[model samples]
Target: MASSTYKRYHVHGYDPRQHLEHYASDKPDMAFEEDVLKFPMENLAKTFSLGHIRGDVLIDFSASCMIHHLYAACEFFNHIIVLKVSERCIMELKKWLDMRTGAFNWGHTLKLHREIQGIGDELPDKEEKMRSAIPHVMICDLEKENMTDPIVLPPADCIISVWLLDNVCKDQDDYIRYLRKCSRLLKPGGHLILLGGLGMTYYTVGKDRFHVFTYDEAFARKALAGEGFVIDDCKVKKRTAMCDLVDYKASIFIVAHKEK
Candidate 1:
């Protein structure tokens, strides 16, 4: 586990609504609009568009309660099992999944994704589709010997992690160690789509600032290669929306498949 002195998000303390308000808001100038929002969604759309990422089960290991990134992948996989580290994030995701009152409005995110897909008219229907694609959202810890301990998850065809490693890994070594854990969940030759920040050291939600593991593009490629994943595609977008809320200068999206 990460040894940072700051309030780590790996625990049960993450405030999902606060994080949503800070990063997932559709406000015109939200600081993380590019890094935390569009990068993953856009890249996901492109990756799935290539017609190579289809499978029976797609496991999502992401940060926060945000659901934007999964909109594009719903059609490619039969079922999506979201693994969350914190109960708070799981509860927040449930609130949205169950369509309860005051669930964070993911409509804007869906709209953004559809716009990227050129299927701008798909709103409420597509929203429901994404919800149906995801049938399970359970708690799991990457630090655990069996990330999905009690429930033995079938080896996934694909795994997508968005910014979760930034919060869970304390350093470069922790990054590789946790990555091996993630790989173990995959079927051999399965895909791994990772989205992370470049040179990002911290992100603030509400009044608390959480630590982020700082790494560059080279380190990312090296780590994935070292862990037996062959890099298929890697894309980097320089931080366009600048703010003090986060320290990342750029964001990265990589599509890799585990070697059989």
Candidate 2:
């Protein structure tokens, strides 16, 4: 979706699938954040319990193709729902899931779609599965759809949106609004895991190059606090570029949880 609003403001600099050693930029030959350190999935599981999932409902916003977190959540939760505002992201996820149809359970993998409310209709059947076959993954985005739309969801037990809000938002105000939207999707005492380049300048995905809004950790913490979320625990780390091109400043990753 090309927008006149975004003239040369491309968000991604390289394709997520490509090797950073191949880039021509002057950035130190690090590695894509996704490929660098295996996201602390085990730690995430320890921090939040799917078994204690408040309302049998877990929602994710702007969950791009990164399904690792989702896969981890399904280990305990029953009904996992994902919403995606970007059709391209949705299609890409579907394609990835399709590849695993043989060993992976598509029906159990998730109910990925354009909206989060769709799960309400399938909650019954979803809860029936017992042996870790939970709806652990759902992706929702605010770009293609409005957060107020009935299709959007209320608060959920676990809410996560990584590398989403900063890239799509128009400015700081827009970013805050998007975070509030994320809060709205969770129940009062749910956990919201937010991760991305805190001021992630420019980077490559695989072959596509894009620019990040340079979101600030301090500002993000304040925004989350303003949204009634308690900074339960937050860890900030510098993200080094993997591409062989120009290495920009380091990026940050933050995690916040909604207060009861």
Candidate 3:
């Protein structure tokens, strides 16, 4: 029998609405936010507060049409450039940024971020800050040497990538190659904050199942070190919730700096 073609997937095959319903809900289960979102945001906040990561231009390589992970970075960077792999993703993000009807509600995410940073009273101001910081949302092709070709972006002080590498890369070598490509967009010694799911091979969206590269903490460290990054913080939160939609064993968060 011929192999199933349903396994074949593309970035555009991803359903933004289903993704939001699954992961960006206002009151996601405890494990969803606590393990997946809070830990990463807290680590980012701690890094910035200690003066380890700062930059005028912050480039978001994994613009997955969600801003939940952006609140922390917005507090530190004045300019945020979001690069998406697919036009569908870009359109989803634009809806939110432009305040179009039926945009995914991120109020819960904003509230959680404020609580994490102890800036509950400054939510409005911070929201405005993020709005002003994110002025550009463009397309990128990770397979290309210049991810954002024909449009040379200024070297960023820091780059944030969340749940991007695993899905795009077919194997470990591709993962490392893409990492190098993204690293090139940052200034020397610039910080790289990575958020990823561990031991994840596939995640379901609506009726489609997409591939995710399987990896672990040790492999992640090795990859970063090989890419000339100095690992500053590595945190792993074991998976505590099980949903039929996604199969991930743990959540890995890393903060590293490119060392030339």
Per-candidate Cα lDDT values, in order, are 0.87, 0.52, 0.80
TM, every model:
0.95, 0.66, 0.93
Candidate 1: pairs in clash = none
For candidate 1, the per-residue lDDT at 93 reads 90
Model 2 stretches with alpha carbons more than 4 Å out: 1-30, 33-37, 40-42, 49-55, 100-154, 205-208, 244-253
For model 3, what is the alpha-carbon lDDT of residue 95?
Answer: 83
- State the RMSD for candidate 1: 2.2
Question: Which candidate has the highest lDDT of all?
Answer: 1
In candidate 3, position 257 carries an lDDT of 91
* Residues 1-260 of candidate 3: C-alpha lDDT, one tens digit per residue: 11223242345557776677777676545236666567777877777788767779999877357787888788788899999887888888888888799888888778788788887667677666787899899988776778788999999999999888877877889889988887888899898999999988777777777778889999999999999999988889888766767788988989999997
Worst 10 residues of 2 by lDDT: 108-117
User: Whose lDDT is higher: candidate 1's or candidate 2's?
Assistant: 1
Q: How far in Å is the alpha carbon of 81 misplaced in model 1?
A: 0.2
Tens-digit per-residue lDDT, 100-123, candidate 2: 442223332233210122333444
* Candidate numbers, best lDDT first, in rank order: 1, 3, 2
Q: Over all chains combined, what TM-score does candidate 3 have?
A: 0.93
Q: Tell me model 1's lDDT, rounded to 2 decimals.
A: 0.87
- In terms of TM-score, which candidate is strongest? 1
Query: After best superposition, candidate 3 residue 11: deviation in angstroms?
Result: 4.1
